[model samples]
Target: MITKYLAILRMKYVEMFAYQLSTMVWMFGTMVQPLITMMVWMNIYPDQGESFVLYFVALIMVERLTSAWDVWEMDRQIREGTFSYQIVRPFHPIHWAIAENIVYKGLFLVVLVPCWIILALFIPSLRLHLSVTGWGLFLAALLLGAVIRFAMSFLFGILCFWMNKVTAIYAMFETVSLFLSGQIAPFSLLPPVVKQISTFFPYRYMIGFPLEILTGTANSHTLMIGFIGSFIWAVVLIVIISLLWNAGLKKNQAVGG
Candidate 1:
């Protein structure tokens, strides 16, 4: 099983490498939004402490690592009947999406790491207060964040089995995520009501909570709350995805087979 997954990862890496230029272009596109947000915030809140820079830089990294565009791919496959090939495979189709997610991010990091180093060096104010323990916790939170984000996206993609237009559904998800996931701004900088509301949803855990840990903005209590919230959301999302996948499979078999 492990070997199969590794093969899938390698296959994805090779495919992505074959179109490295396009991959790099997409990486730049991803960077643009966060870079613009960082610049705007820096100018608007020039007096804000070093934490501001650290937070946004961490936000950029988290955004790059945790992003999942598999929904679009899955939607295309389902719509085009390409997904039928996966249905007959021994493994679940979702594994392909998961492998693609890992490969895409790993490849993008080859470019992202140097860019990050340059940003950190050129920007004197962007200081990270990272401890050994914090690094461990931050990685754990990041993994959980990635899983939650992937599950949410895959679940939405499964909607393609029933709906003819999944793009609008995905757009709505992205629209809400932009405001609630701290992609627009740090949760701390949001209005009080918005901040409180963000905490209640899984969106913050998807990106901002991990960024808070990485930037040393989250205290012990906040970290504990984040971990608990993230775990709950992860489990809930997993269950939801499983149920949706089964339902979608049945629907697909009924309609297409």
Candidate 2:
């Protein structure tokens, strides 16, 4: 079973790489979001402290680097009423999504690192304390975040089956996440309500928690708690998706063999 999944996952990469122009667009200016955020925020916090810059610069890059809203694709498949195709297939629909995620991020990360170095040079206020231990912890947390994020997306996508215009809900959630997930600023700087509530929200787990740990702000104990929280969220989300998909499969209105 695992081997079959591995094979399918490999083919997803080949398919993604076939689109050269799209791949180029993804790599070149995808970093623009961070650049804009950095410029605006740097103007706001020009001399607060170097730590903020270090973390803020890394925050923009990390947020941009980790960004994915697979819900759109999920909603598309369901709206086109083609989700039945995946249901009849021998493998989980999520397997393909996972493969797609790996391929896109892996390919882009190749180019992103060199760009990170260049950005670090240009932005004197930017500082990153990259160490072996920090990198290892960050990678582990990142992988966990990916799983949780994907499951959340899968859930949002499935919601379209029961509700009209659920995309609006997802968009609203995206707006909240941008602020709460440390994508705009450190979670530390947020209001007590924002910070307190963010910990309960999955977006903070998906981005801000890992960002703080990577930059050495959350500390070991808090980082452990964050990772555990994220892992548990991923598990719960997967379970929810399984139950919903089972129900959805029974109601599938699309044709299939």
lDDT of 1 at 82: 80
Which tens-of-lDDT digit does each residue in 93-151 have in candidate 2?
87777778777777767766777678778876554676888888888887777777778
Top candidate, metric lDDT: 1
Cα lDDT of model 1 by residue, 1-257, tens digit = 89999999999888987988887788777767877888888888888746666776778789888988878887888888888888889999889889999888887677777877787787875656588998999999999999999998888888888988887888888889889999998877899899888877889898999988887778988899999999999999999888888888889842343
Lowest summed lDDT across 10 adjacent residues in model 2 is found at: 248-257
Against the true structure, candidate 2 has what lDDT?
0.75
- Clash pairs, candidate 1, are none
Winner by TM-score: 1
lDDT for model 1, please. 0.84
